[model samples]
Target: MKTPATPPNEAERLLSLRQSGLLEFDNRQPYDRLTRLAKRLFNVSVAMVNLIDERTQIAKSVDGAVPAVLPRSVSFCGHTILQPEPLVVNDARDDSRFVDNPLVAHENGVRFYAGIPLRLPDGAVVGSFCVVDQTPRDFSAQDLAALSDLAALAEDEFAASCAATTDELTGLINRRGFNQFAAFALSGARRRAEPLTLAWMDLDRFKQINDRFGHSEGDEALKAMANLLRSAFRETDLLVRYGGDEFAVLFADTDEQGAWIAMQYLTEQVAKFNQTGSHPWTLTFSWGICEFDHHHGDLEQWLKEADRKMFSMKQKNSAAR
Candidate 1:
């Protein structure tokens, strides 16, 4: 069996893929529609929209009974992203590259494959839009053109998904993005029996900054808060600008004590920022942490528990002031 070679601009490609926000959100309706269309148009047994990250090939939309995720090394889409043109395998059994591949060697497995690299506007190839069949078949020029057209639509949907999920001011995921991402994150955490913590935070006296220092300064403060969160959290953690001065972080694989330690570091970062005296006002926030309970409730309830704690802290701080 042969494995796909990593792209020369692999780091940049992965960064672009992450920035596209396709992996974070669970809204696959747009991509699903495209895959459905592709399956019918090409008369293929399987059609899928996949995103290749550092280690896994994620199926954002699939029309077949294939696994939602697969290792990048074994994914045909991994090879598809290597080129600008479509990868057409007329017969995998006859091809040396995939003759011994598990997908090809198994009964009723992949015999035909056609995939187009899904590129972002910046020209980084993120993944592939592919169609697979159990029987070998020749691909015509017309077939290739149609597939390309469908892939184009998929790219458009990718851009749209990013815009919808991302906050314009801070580049963090918004509330909608949180809802989609948190659901999946929680599910995975539960299945793996890993500790997952949620931190709900609000900037202290944020409105005062806007009123006294002007809204521009308020924007700057918000951006600084976002930057602080980015610097403090891991890439695997989900950081969100819940709206206005409220922000959130899902500490993946972290319990309440672990989250508290992270928050302590964040508090120090905020203190250091204030010491710089670069701005008229200082950055301070009140936050509350809650560990997820698998048997308890859904994402909404978890969020509410965290928010309630945060609000309680904010009130105590206000009373102290």
Candidate 2:
């Protein structure tokens, strides 16, 4: 039997896998649901989300009673991650690549196998979402499309995983986390017919602060901003430190006017903080709010609208000064 060839970016791929923290991930509910759906939809005997590490294939989630770990040399998933497309073997016994592989040569082995590589946003192939059957079967174009969709969802779960989602500095959700939670919030808003407002915030003269006080002080300013956001916004709201000095808040079940009122409170809190001389520099910011339209656009589009408005406000404030 031939061993799966190592990926060209094997070192980088392994680093991404380890950093993702999926190997030691304990929460398997989301993955289990996806695998279960795949098994039911495809009528497969085994459905699993498998993470391929350096020497072993770890099943993060499985719907069948299969071993949680397997030698990478003999793993079908090890080959799946090598390409950009789904790997489908109608009969592994008939394919030279997997013909002698123990998984197929054994009793009640994997006869039909279909797997789509699960990729991190950074284009690293860390694992695969696969469905296995004891009997050989044909996989149609429609089957491949369905599997791809499920695999995309699985990838989202990985991006939203704790290891990947948080901004290490401020303990706020990063952009990746925003994508996952924002999608869920939008879905919930649509279903419940509730209003959802998004706010974009930028720290005014933030670069000057870094230039004058050093990066350490800039970090402190960011932490202060994050803390202020936490104190001002409700716990239900989604707060994110969206890169450098940019921040965002998704106000659930709130309208544009309500969000504006909350911003007013945050402004007051900022003024109080400055008056207290809590830090070396005074805090100031520019912000804009947008109410999401359920029928109109996506999260990125919505974010752009708010960002455009915030930029406009920033420019106007600068001109006034």
Residue-wise C-alpha lDDT for candidate 1, range 210-300, written one tens digit per residue: 9998988999999999999999989999999987798999999999999999999999999999999989999989999999988876777
- Once fitted onto the true fold, the runs of candidate 1 whose alpha carbons sit more than 4 angstroms away are 165-321
Model 1, 173: alpha-carbon shift in Å? 4.9
Instruction: List CA RMSD, all candidates.
Output: 16.5, 14.1
> What residue pairs clash in candidate 2, if any at all?
none
- The total number of steric clashes, by the backbone 3 Å criterion, in model 1 comes to 0
- Cα lDDT tens digits for candidate 2, 74-120: 99999999999899999999999988888889898889999999998
Model 2 clash number = 0
Which residue pairs does candidate 1 place in steric collision?
A: none
List the global CA lDDT of all models: 0.90, 0.90
Error of 2 at 201 (Å): 0.5
